[model samples]
Target: MTFHYTRLANGLEILGESMPQSRSVAVGFFVQTGARNERPEEAGVSHFLEHMVFKGSERRTAWDVNRDFDAIGAHYNACTGEETTLYYAAVLPEYLFAALDILTDILRPSLRPEDFDTEKQVILEEIRMYEDQPAWSAYDEAVALFFGDHPLGHRILGTVESITALTRQQMLDYYRRRYLAGNIVVAVAGRLDWEATAAWLAEHCQHWPAGATPRRVTPVVSRPARKSVHRPQVNQEHMFLLTPAPPVESELRYAAEVLATILGDDTGSRLYWALIDTGRADSADMSYHEYQGAGAFFTYLCCEPADAAANLEITLETFRTAVRQGITEEEIRQAQSKLASRLVRGNERPQGRMRSLGYTWIYQHEYRSVDEELGRLRAVKREHLSQLLEQYNLLEPTIVALGPLAELAGTVFPAS
Candidate 1:
C-alpha cells in the first residue's frame, strides 16, 4: 500500500491509499462530528444535516445525485453513526473522478427549507421504525444504559420531538459549526492518480473556509445500568448486555475483540452453540465497538419469553467464568484466528477497504499499513488474553431488555 496526505490551508485532511490490484476505487468523505458531539437539545442535528446534504447540493438536485451515479454504473451512499457521518462511493477505476465530484457536491449541499421539512418527516418515520423493532430497540436501550446521560446515550436518529422542532437555521448552524474543513477527511483506496486526485479536490475545496472547531468529545467513565421495558406486543424478548472496555488505541483493544468473538461472534461461537443450538435463543450474537475515546463489548440475545431468563443467566455465567477461570489455549487461538480472518476479509471489498482506511486514519491520525496491523494481531498470546481478561472483565454490565418481563424482577445486571 502507498499512502499520501495533504492538509488544506483551511484544515481539510485528505489522504489516499493506492491499490493497483483492484479495478475499482473507493472514496470516503468523513466528518468527525457525530451523535456524541451534540448537546441534548441538538440530539439529531448532526444526523439530520447528513440527510439534508444529499437532498440537494450546489450543483445537483437530489434526483440528479442518484441519476448521474446510476448513469456511470457507480455505487454510492452515506450513513450517520455515533461518531462520524461517512459518505462513500465506489466505481470502476476509470470513473473515479466522477464519483469524487458527486461526493464533493453532496458535502456542500444547499439546505433548502422545503427539503428540510420533507426529510424531517422521513427521519421521524425512521425513528418510529426503530421504536417498533425489539431487537434494534434493545441495542439503543443498551447504549443508553451504558452511557446514562452522556451524549453517547442518545439515539443517532434522535427523538421525534428533537427532529420536528429543528429549524432550517438550526440545521445550517450545525453545518457551519461542525462541517469545517478541519473536521473533514477525504480518503480514497484502490487505484488512482494521487497527485491528480489531490489537485482536483484542492481546486474545488480551496476556498472552503474553516468554521469553529467542533467540540472535542469527552471520555466518560461508563458504569453498569439496567432497564427493562415490557412491551407485550412484541413476540420475542430482546436482551442486550454491554461491558465497558478501553478506547480504540488501548493495548487491550484487540483482546476485547477476541473476547467478544469467543462469546457471540457468529453461528459457531459460544452463544450460538450454547443458546441457539440448544433452542435457548432464537437468534444471538456479540460484537465489539471501539470508539474514538472509548469502547464497549456487547452481547445480544433474542429469545422467547419462556427461555429468556435461563438464556440470560447462562450467558452471564459463561462470560464470568471465562474471565475468572481463563480461556483455553484452543479457544484463544480460535478467537484470535477468527478475528484476524475477519480483518482480512473485510478489506476485500472496496467499501470495506474505504471504511477500514478511514477509521484507521481517524483513530491513529496516521497510516497503519495493512501488513503492520496483521502483525499486531498475530503476536497476541494466551497470557496476554488472561491479562486482558483481568483488565476488562465485565463483572458489572449495563443491561437492556424489551419484552414481557413481568416474570423477571430486577436482575442484578450492570448499571451504566
Candidate 2:
C-alpha cells in the first residue's frame, strides 16, 4: 500500500491511499462545513444543502446522475454531521473514475429552485421519521442538554420550523461560502494509478470555485446538567449520560476508547453484565464522539420506564467502581486487545481505509499507518485511564432522557 497527499494550485487538497491488493475502491468528498457553521436561524441548511447536491448539477439531470451511479453499481450516499458533510461511494476498481465523476459533479450542485422545493419536503419527512424513533430523539436531546446553545450541540437535522423556513437563495449563498476548495478534501482509497486519478481531478475540477477559507468553529461551552423529555409515543425510556471530553487530536482519545470499551462494551463488559445480563435494561452501551474542537463521551440506555432510574444508578455505580477500585489489569489488557484488534481488522478493506483517510486528514491533519494507530492504543497504560477518570471527572454525568418521566423532572440522578 502507498499514500499520496497533494495541494492543487487551486487550494483543494487531494488525499488518497492505494492498496493494490484490494478489488474495491472508495472515494469521498469531505467538506469542512455543517450545522456548526450555520447561523442561528440556518439550523438545517447544512444538511438541506447536502440533499440538493444530488437533486441536480450543471451538466446532469437528477435522473441522469442516479442512472449513471446505478449503471456502475456504485453504493453511494451522503451525510451531514456537527462539523462536516461527506458524499462518498464504493465500487469495483474499474468504476473508480465513473464514481468520481458523478460524485464531483454533484458536489458542484445545481441547487435549482424547483429541486430545492421538492427536496425540502423530503428532508422534512426524514426529520419527522427520526423524531418518531425514541433512541435517535434521546441522543439528540442529550446533545442539546449537554452543550446548550453551543454550535457543537446544534441538531444536524434542523427542526421542522427551521427547515420549512429555509429558502433556495439562502442555501445557494451557503453553498458558495462553505464549499470552497481550501475547505474541502477529496479522499480516495483502493487500487488506482495515482497519476491518472490526479490528472482527472485537476481537469474536471479546474472550474471549481476558489473562495476564502471558512472561519474556525467557535469553542463550545458545556452545560453539564440533566434534563428529561416526556414522550408518550414510546414503550421504553431512553436515557443518555453525556460528558465533555478531549477533542479528536488528543492522545487521551486512545485511553478514552479503552475506558468506554472496558466499562460498557456490548458483548460482555461491565454494563452488559450489570444491566443487560440481569435484565435491568433492554440495551446499554458507551461511545465517544470526537469533533474538531469539541468532543463528548456518551453512555446510552433503553429500558422500561419503571427501570429507568434503577438502570441509570447501576450504570453510574459501574463507573464509580472502576474509578475507586481501579480497572483490573486483566480488564485493561483485554480492552487494549479488543480495540487494537478492531483497528487492524477494520483497515483490511477500501471502505474502511477510506474512512481512515478522511478522518485522519480532517481532524489530525496527518496520517498514521494502521500499525502505528494500534501501537498508540497498545502503549496506553492503565494509569492513563485512571488519570483521565480522576483529572477530568468522567463519573459525574450530564443526564438526558426521553419517555414518560414526568415524575423524574426537577430531579438529577444521584452519582453514587
Candidate 3:
C-alpha cells in the first residue's frame, strides 16, 4: 500500500493510502488549529469547538450521527490537542463515502445556542474532573512553569473559570475564523479507490469555504526556572525532568528519540535498570515531544514517597552518566532496532498508517515512506545520541514533582 494525494477545488487536502488487501478504510480530518490558537480570554475555545461539533449539526442530531455510524459498524472519534484537532474513524470500505459525509457535516457544525450552553457546563465539569487527578493537575502546573508566557503553555482543556465565562458568541466567532477548508486535511487509508474518493470530495467539499493551513508561532522554550510542584495530598511522588530539544522536522529528532529509548525504555533503558528494576520507582521512562519548531525531552519517574529523594538522585545521575560516559555502540544499535521494530509493528494496521500519514503531513507538510522513516532511524549513530545529551543541557533540568512532600521534602523538591 502507498499514499496518494491531491486537493479539492475549495482547497481541502485529499490524502489517501491504497490498501486493496484490507477490508476497512481508516479516514481522518486534520485541522491545524488548536489550543495555541486561542487568546488568553478564550483559552478553551478550540476544545470547546471539538465538543460543539458533536453536540449537533445542521443535518443530524448528535444521536443520528452516532446511530448512522453505528449502523455502518464504524469506529469514529475525535480528539483535541495543543496543536491539532483530529476526527477519525475506521469502517468497511463500502461505508467510506458515508463516513466522510458524516465527518464533513460535523466539521461545519451548527453551534446552536441551547447546545452551546449545555456543552459549556460539560466542558467546565471536565476541567474540574482533571483538577481532581493529581497527575493531570501536576502536569498542567508543570506546563505553566515550563512554557511561561508562551502560548504553548496554554492547556488544551483550558481552565474551569475560563470555560465557565466563555460565551457562545466567542466560540462561534472562533469557529468562523479557525475551522475552514484551508485549515483541514482529509486523509483516508485502506481498500479504496483514490479516484472515487477524490470525486466524492469534489462534490461535497468544492462548495465549502477555503483558507490556508494555519501555522503555529514556535515558542522559545527556555530551561525551567522553578520546576517542582508540591502537592501535599497525594500518596506517592510523580516527578518529571525536562530539557529542550528539536522539532518534528529536524534530523536530530530521530537521534533524540533513540536517546530517549536508551535512557527510559521499559527494559534495557538506563533509567529502567537504575530506577524501575531496582524497585525504587513504580514507573520510569523517557519520552520526546515534538511540535512545529519546538520540542522537549521528558524523563518521568514515579515512586513511593519514601524513595522520592533516592529516585530523584538516581534519575539525575542516570542522565549525568550518559553525558559523561555516553551510551555504548551496542546500546545505540539495540535502541535503533527496537524503535524500527515498533514503528513497523505499529503500522501493520491501516488505521495506524492513516494516522501516520495525517500527522506527517500536518506537522512536516511532507510524506515520508515507511522505508524512509526506518532509514532515518537506522541512520542514528552513537555520537548523535551522546552529542545531544551533552549539547543540550540534559544535566541541569527543570524539574516538576507532584505528591506527598514529607518523604521527598528537602531532597527532591527544587526551591521555587
Candidate 4:
C-alpha cells in the first residue's frame, strides 16, 4: 500500500492509502485539539462536541444522519483522545464519496439547542460510566499525577460539574475557533478514486475558513510524583510507575517501545511471565506513550492490596535488569516480529486503516506508508535499543498508587 498526501493552500491535509482488492473504504477527519487543548473548566468539551456533531448537521437531521448510514450498513463513529479527535466512517467502496459527504456534514454540525439538551444527558452518563471503572479511574489518576496542573492532566470526560456549565454558545465558539482547515486532516484508505475524492473534498471544504495558526502552548513538565492514593471501597490496588521520555518524532521513541514490549508485551513479556504467571499480581503491564511534542513511559499494575510493595519492587527490578543486561537477540527478534505482524493484521479492516491514516497524518503531518514503518521496525537492532536506554535512563519514575495499602503514603521520596 502507498499513502499519498497533499496540503491545500488553506492548510487542510488530504491523505490517502491505496489498498487494492479491499471491499471497503474508510475515511476520517482528524483534529489536533482534544482534552489537552481544554482548560480545567472546559474539560469535557472536546468529547461533548464530538457527540453533538452526530446529533444534527446543516444538511442532515439527526434522524437522517442515522438513517443514511444505517441504510448502507456503514460504520461511523468518533473518539476523543489526549491530543486528537478522530471522526471516521467505513462503508463499501461504492459508497466512498457518499460516506465522505455525510462525514463532512457531521463535522460542520448545526449545533441546535434541542440536540444539545438531549446530548448533555448522554455525556453526563458517559462521565458516570468512566467513574465506575477501576482501571479507567486509576489510569486517569496516574495522568494527573504525571502532569500535575497542566492541560494534559485534565480528564477527558470532564466532571459532571464542568459539563453542566457549558452553554451552546460556548461550544459553538470553540467550534468556530478551532475547526479551521489548517488544524485539520482528512485520511482515507481502501478502494477509492484519489482524484475524484480530492476534488470533492476541496469543493465541500472550501467553506471552512483558512489559516489562523493555533497559538502555541508550552510543554508539560513532570511535577513531584503523587505516591499513593487510597479509596478503601476498592478491593484491589492499582499503581503506576511513570517517567519522562522524548516526543513522537524522537529516535528514542522506538527504543521506549522496545523496552515496553520486553517488559509487558504479551504472555512471554517480563511482567506477564514474572508477576502474573507467578501469581504475585492479578494484572501487570508497561505502557509507552509519546505525545505530539513530548513523551512519558510507565508501568501499570494491579494486585491484592497486601502484595503492592513486593509487586512494585519486582517491576522496577525487571526493568533495571533489562536496561543493564540489554535484551537478548532472540527477545528482540521475537518482539520485532510480533509488532510487525500485528501491524499488518490490524490494518486489514477498513476501520483500522482509517485510524492508522488519521494517526500518522495528525502526528507527523505527512503520511508514512505502512511498508516504510515496517521496514524501520525490521531495521531496529539490539544495539539501537541499548544505546537508547543508556542515553535515556528513566530510573526516577513518577509513582502513583491507589488502594487501602499504606506503602505508597507520601510522594515517592527523592522525586528525582
Best by TM-score: 2
**Which candidate number maximizes lDDT?**
2
RMSD of each: 2.0, 1.6, 2.2, 2.2
Model 2 lDDT per residue over 1-416, tens place: 88898877778889888899988989999998988889877889999998888887888989998999999999999989888899999999899999998998888888888888899999999999999898999889888888887887789989999999988888888888899888889888998888888889988886788854665766767756877788877788899998777778789988888888988898769999999999888889998788877677899999988888878878878877887888878888999989888887889888888888887888888888898888899888978988878765666678888897765533354454
Task: Please provide, for model 3 over 104-182, each residue's C-alpha lDDT reduced to its tens digit, 9 standing for 90 to 100.
Answer: 8888898889888988888889999998887777678777777778888899999988888899889988887887788
Give the candidate order by descending TM-score.
2, 1, 3, 4
lDDT-sorted candidate list, best first: 2, 3, 1, 4
Which consecutive 10 residues in model 4 have the weakest lDDT in total?
A: 407-416
Q: How does each model score on lDDT?
A: 0.82, 0.85, 0.83, 0.81
Q: Write the per-residue lDDT of candidate 4 for residues 1-416, one digit (tens) a residue.
A: 76677778888889888888788989899987888888676778989999998987878898999999887778888898878888888899889888887888888899999999889999999888987777777788888888888777878888899999999988988888778899898888898888888998988897787875463566877854666676788889998877777788776776677777877875689899999999988889887888877788778899988788778777777767887777888888888878888888888876788788888766765666668778877787888888877765556677878777655633243321
Please give the lDDT score for candidate 2. 0.85
Residue 304 in model 1: lDDT: 86
Q: Residue pairs in steric clash, candidate 4?
A: none
Task: After the best TM-score superposition of candidate 1, give how far the Cα of residue 179 lies from its true spot, in angstroms.
Answer: 0.6
Superposed Cα deviation of residue 411, candidate 2 (Å):
7.8
TM-score of each: 0.96, 0.96, 0.95, 0.94
Winner by lDDT between candidate 4 and candidate 1 = 1
Cα lDDT of model 1 by residue, 138-232, tens digit:
88888887888777787899898998887888778778888888888888988889999999999988778775475566776777677788888
